[model samples]
Target: METTPAPAAPARRRRSRAPFPVTVTQMPMATCQVCGRALAHRKGEVSAILTAHYERDHPELLGR
Candidate 1:
């Protein structure tokens, strides 16, 4: 008698994934209250700069 052949195996499938989420923010800059001028000082130098600016640019206000 004759024999028959065997059957073949099935193929496998691949998986897919998504990327992560992200968020961004920005801080506000400092400005002079009197004339609305911009300042370029560091963290703790605003007060001194404002005081000097007021004294030199606005000496009349010192009387008050």
Candidate 2:
């Protein structure tokens, strides 16, 4: 009697799906109700580099 070995199966390759489209909605400008002035509000920003240097080097100026 003779024995035979089976062939190995091929590996599958996965493909990524396409990204969704992005659309930006425009917001209207705000106006001040009092004093009849065009109002613009800016959210606060902080810099770690500047704050660290100022606090470390100029501790005296902070109190004054």
Candidate 3:
């Protein structure tokens, strides 16, 4: 009697990879807490900017 051929092995499934995208973020800006107004410069700004702001708005606090 003739014998039947064996069955072939099953194919392996491919795995999917996760995709990554580039992202950008903004930095916090400097602001005055006294009047709750935005500052002209960013964080770590020069003292002159602060002095000018105070002299202009809070001159009384400066005590000339």
Candidate 4:
């Protein structure tokens, strides 16, 4: 007797933007307080970075 073949799995949809989980220990490269933009360039002025409101709601700056 011939065995029946297994059914094929459903195809997954390709995503342009994928959701991911991040750990707390991982420090961001560069943070922008105004627009909440992650950048490579460091902020020269401490006051500018600290005083500006970050859209992303950076938790690292909470205590400091």
Candidate 5:
């Protein structure tokens, strides 16, 4: 008696997980409001550098 070959195994179906949504907040770089010049700051604090630049470049605005 001839035996029939075993049926082929079913192909594996891979399950994928949905990607998670992420929220991000970015801080803008400091710039001189008068001349539009780029300013540098340390640890996200730019007031000192910005103030110095303004005082040097646009001294007239300091009184106001």
Candidate 6:
């Protein structure tokens, strides 16, 4: 006698929601004019820290 084959399982249904892309904004940081290093500041705004850094790092360039 011939045997019958079993039926295959149904495919699963997935959610229709699509994934969203994320974006980020980067602000530029201030750099020290004397040593060419990044200066410490907040919200992309420079303060007296740059001046103090220049005076302490390169006082010879201040007079020129």
The lDDT leader among the candidates is 5
lDDT at 44, model 1: 76
Q: Where does model 5 exceed 4 Å of error? A: 1-28
Give the alpha carbon lDDT tens digit for every residue of 1-64 in model 3.
Answer: 9999999889988769766887865545557768977765655664667788889999888896
Candidate 2: stretches off by over 4 Å:
1-46
TM-scores vs. true structure, each candidate? 0.46, 0.26, 0.45, 0.25, 0.48, 0.43
Better of 3 and 4 by lDDT: 3
lDDT of each: 0.72, 0.50, 0.75, 0.57, 0.79, 0.74
| Model 1: how far residue 56 lies from native, Å | 0.9
lDDT of 1 at 14: 67
In the range 1-64, model 2's lDDT, one tens digit per residue, is 9978788888887768777899976433344333244333333322443444456666666673
TM-score of 1: 0.46
In terms of TM-score, the best-performing candidate is: 5
User: Which clashing pairs does model 1 show?
Assistant: none
Q: After superposition, how far is residue 49 of candidate 5 from its true place, in Å?
A: 0.4
**Residues 1-43, model 4: lDDT tens digits:** 9999999999998898967987655333555645566654344
Worst ten in a row by lDDT for model 1: 23-32
Which should have the higher lDDT, number 5 or number 6?
5
